[model samples]
Target: MKEVIRSADPRIAALIARQATQNRDRDQLGLDRISALLEAVGRPQDRLPPIFHVAGTNGKGSTCAFLRAALEAAGKRVHAFTSPHLVRYNERIRIAGKLIEDAQLGELMDRVLDANEELGASLFEVNTAVAFLAFSEAPADACILEVGLGGRLDATNVVEKPLVCGIASLGLDHQAFLGDTLNEVAAEKAGIAKRGVPLVTQIYPSAIAERIGEIAHDVGAIWEPRGLHWEAGVRQGKLRYRDRQGAMDLPLPRLPGKYQAMNAALAVAMLRHQSQIAIPASAYGAAMGWTQWPARLQQLHGGPLFAMLPKGSELWVDGGHNPSAAQLVADYAKRQWTDRLPLVLLFASLQSKDAAGTLRPFKGIATEVLTLPIDGHECRTPRELAHLAESMGLPARPCSSLSSAMTALAKPARVLVFGSLYMAGELLALNGPLPD
Candidate 1:
């Protein structure tokens, strides 16, 4: 899908407007167009530093964040590329430990798009191209990349070789694109396993793990699934990770949810498994608090969105939309704070997602739900979502808009804004701390 990116910078806005006209979706999984486009623009991927590529249904973004944090904490200049920018399109590409400035971003986008006008590249592909061009030219010690979609045909998969590859928590998501079965999904994720690279992954069901293993073997990747070649867990309020190399009992992640520790552990294992980069064990401890992935169980503070909530109410925003992701959010809600105030779920999601299944997990956990349409995309109407919530046994009602929802929400409660990353981006723009 073409991303509708709104930028305050006029230069960036122009580039985004031009990119919109060139956007086209890839009906099948392959990298012929992107690879050609990259070659046309001067194969920038070949110039990147030690690359840390990550893929999975979930937690991959967090794993990339942890990897960047750890490498930077170890005094390395890092270049990171992640998908679905929260607040700005520039958020997708970071150059030498800082977000690419508007001038730099606009120039890069124009250069890539202008050169590949007939290449028929999508917004994500062009964005990937821009990142590679920028990262290649910039001076950085390491590169961290998160797979935009499935690993096999993702634009970022153009990387022929990387220092390490990791797969985070797997789950049922994007069945329409990847596959309906867990084994198929696992194989799709394991496609990032490059020859001679460590394919670090979370422990999966036996069948799914074996499928991933098969892919690794086919690709000649070093398969290092958890509970086999490596192990990590949350124990005694600490994240303990161990492998043949050694063990490091690190602190928990600053991000909310118990699962973040495992994501951090995946990053540590990737670092430990590879020798291209020299990362200290102490950096792993620092990454526990150093990593910051916006909208992943992130709490808002005195923002425009937070001000809408009733007094004494808390506000948290998470962009995860899958049912497994919703369960994690529900679990965090149940464990994090006492229910002194009612839990109000302010939700919206894409029409393609299993909205009913995603919302069902939070049926009893949320005291009330306020549904709103995710603007600029095909989304489940508020009435439809409200009906689903009602069928799931929770009282839900649709509002005309977020402003209207805020106006009607006068009762004190803990509010969580859930759904698509597009919604998260809108919230961040209206609120503060816009993805620096």
Candidate 2:
């Protein structure tokens, strides 16, 4: 998906526009161009601090957030890189405990573009190179790198030796780039394992877990699957963790939904198994309440967009666009809003997504689905989505915009804006909290 970015700084905007025109598909699923691009920029990946590389179909970003919060709470300056920024491109790159400033971001983008005079790299490849370039020069104790795509060929996988690697909850997503089957997707995520490095993962099905074990064995990695080596969950209104080291009782993540408990546990597992940094038990508890990932069950307290809605109405948003993600969202909605009537959904998705499968889980949960087209991308048409929803026995209607949808609603209700991350980003811009 190509993003049409709007930056507050003119210099930064101009540099981003210039870099957007070079080799869009050159780094679709390979590291050749990225390696050359990094070499041109002095091979910064080799000079960085200890890295904690994370990859999976879902909850990987949340796991990275958990890791950063715990590290920071322990008085460590942490650098983090996450994808599909909710509002600005600056959200993708975070320098030592802060979002990169405008002047430095412009300078870094310019430096990377200037070095790639002969090499045509994709936008993501250049962005990855810029992250390593900046992290190498900045002073930080640890770095958390999230894989933008599948783990095997993602540009972030160029790091030779990481302190630890983590794989979060796995499901079917990006089938065009990864594979259509669960086994193939698990393999792509397991490729990040390195010799002598601990690959801490949330337990999967028997066959998928065995497949990942095979890859780790072939690469000489220490494979530690959950339920065998370490495990954690909300047992009695408190998070319970147990491993070979010991057992820990911690607070659950403040993030909504039950799935977040596992993500926080993955971060705890990664931090505990690694020897690079020493974190106190208090820091792990601090992370549960401190960590926040926007557009994932985020509620709008007050904003320009909120004033347009009806009174006593609640607005929630999420960036889940796959079948597995939708199932989780539906579960959260039913458990949270069972008493509320007229559960409305304003949704859109990209062209390559499985719209039918994505909407299947929410058929009976939604009161009315308002379909809209996402701006500046090849998105599903509103009429097309409405038809699909109807086929699945859902009450759906096509609308031109949010205002039109609001006017068409019959009564007060709860609204959930979900489907595409790109759509979630646009909604956040209209809503509050632009990712600092």
Candidate 3:
């Protein structure tokens, strides 16, 4: 699938616009294109700093955020690359703890495009090459790479030797490319495991964990799972983590949602298990508060979008599109909304997503739903989404715009906007508090 991206800078916009005309090798999933592109550009991936690679259906981006926060807290200059930018394309590549400047990004994009225009590299492949090129030429202490999709043939998986590898919460997503079954998906994600690298992961069901372990073992990776090698839990509002090295009590993540604690712990475990990085216990505590990943159960302040809601009502947004992610959002709503002011969902989804499976989790929890359309991309019609929600025993209505949806609500209620990252980006762009 072609990723939708826009830029205010014309130079960058022209470069991105040309991508639409390029050959999109969606059916093929091998390293031939990316490897060839890298070779044309002098193989910058070989000169990168000690890397921390992460992969999963969800939480991988948040895991990378925690890793960058903790690494920077330890006084290290970190370079990170994540996907599906919420606001700007610059959010995908952070060079030396700052977003890549427009001048630098334009130059790099032009150079890479000119070097390998014949390779038919996808947009993501071009992004991966640009990030590696920037990280190699710059001076940084660490580099964090988040797998764009399934790890086996993800462009970011080109790294041969990372300092450590981690996998976050896994669920069924991108079944066409990854696999239909959860175990098959787990094996594809565990493909990032390299020989002698510490493959740290969250606790999973025995069957899923066994599948992951089998792949890791086949590649000679030292599998360090949560229950066996390291463990962490939230007790009395503190995150206590223990490994073979030692134990430490750290502050819970300042980011909202109960699942963020698990993401934070995975970062701590990855840092502690590695011998290359020297991260102090104090850094872990600082990271808990320093981490800043937007649009994951993030509450809105006084913004254009928030202003549309009824007075005294709360407004929140999440970019969760899969079944597992929807369950997390539903669980959070049940736990946090003690007053029960009635739950409303402003939802939209891509055409490729399982709309019914995504809506199944909120069957009984949502009081009402208003469906909207995602502009400039292939998406499910609002009427289609409304019908899906209505079929699940939830009252739903199709609206032309979010503005109209807010106007239709006569009562004050907590409004949660979700369904797709493209919609999340549209929300953040319209409102304030853009991702930094």
Candidate 4:
């Protein structure tokens, strides 16, 4: 059964891959294709439980993780769908707190592929349809859907009425698809808002905020902008949340980084604002301490990667690839290494990313940069990355492979593997480590 699924369905894979490569010009902003595909599948998207549709350039995944954890803590069965799976394709679809089984994934893919034979739907569109189909068939109290791309025409946006829509920390990314400016990006993320739904968002620059607000108002969504409707701050080693409903004192999120606190707060606010799921205060605390999103500032342990490092040595991995993510990573590393800094970085990014801007934050923080390829994806050559590092006054070397890079480390030094989530997935698979 696994073989049948794993074997290349050339016709399907080729079509999907082709769609992934197509330039999504702004003119291509409509849900016609996705709606048609879903309708052929019996409109499973309409049958889903209350959805928490999230869109952003960063922090959206962590927000989704917090939402699922909170719902599960309240003893509710939650279905979740995320994108660009780190390791297994199954990671994209979760049913009632479990990754979709191989057989079920295969069946759903078959149905979607069959339906798209004439429609030529994009890979994301087919996958979105499959996720809705599975979520509808399964019994769950709520669903958390993460946007696969810019929200306006993103396949996931086909869901007309989400319980609540959220836009996390936004930044410039996918410039080819989205736009060049931050305001353009904000408008794209804000496209998930629906009529009468609460569109929760983090505070952005005034111009960007106004654009998002305009989009929300245009859609008739009640915009719950941060600093106005809800806010959260870290004080006394805890996160304090306040909104019109009231205030709540919550423990810090188990997830590392100060940014996660905001993501957790967004989840809490979205839940608090919605009426479908009755999440108790206890669930908020549980979410703060129980949620874990892998490959985001994750410290590697008990794996082949760990074995290669010296005892007491710290090794961390994050899939952060853009400038905003780079800034966050820099802030976290700076706080973590006030006394001791990371020895080096094994870094690589897709051809389209701003490699120079992304690595700028690591200047002076990393002892050296060892560049390598991100398998199964278009990647910048290690030499290219090394040149960029050199231009920025950082010591760097291009390595042919990860093993070669690891072998070059002389002693136990803190190391970080970053740049692309696809690379992180390859590392986890090679180390036989499964995401929790």
Best by TM-score: 3
| Model 1, span 299-410: residue lDDT tens | 8878876787788878788998988889888888788766578888888989889888788888778899999898878899999999988998989989867667776787
**lDDT of candidates 1 onward, in order:** 0.87, 0.88, 0.91, 0.86
TM-score of each: 0.97, 0.97, 0.98, 0.94
Q: Residue 237 CA error for candidate 1 (Å)?
A: 0.9
Compared with the true structure, what per-residue lDDT tens digits does model 3 show for residues 1-436? 6677899889999999876577566567878899999999999999999999999988999999999999999999999999989988999999999999999999999988887668878888889999999999999999999999999999998899999999999999999899999998999999999999999999999999999999999999999999999999999999989999988888889987778999999999999889998998888999999999999998887788778788888888899999899999998888878686988999999998988888888887889999999988899999999988988898999998877887888889988888998888888888868899
- The per-residue C-alpha lDDT of model 1 at residue 68 equals 89
Q: Give the TM-score of candidate 3.
A: 0.98
Task: Write out the backbone clash pairs for model 4.
Answer: none
Q: Which candidate would rank higher by TM-score, 1 or 3? A: 3
- Rank order (by lDDT, best first): 3, 2, 1, 4
**Model 1 lDDT at residue 369:** 94
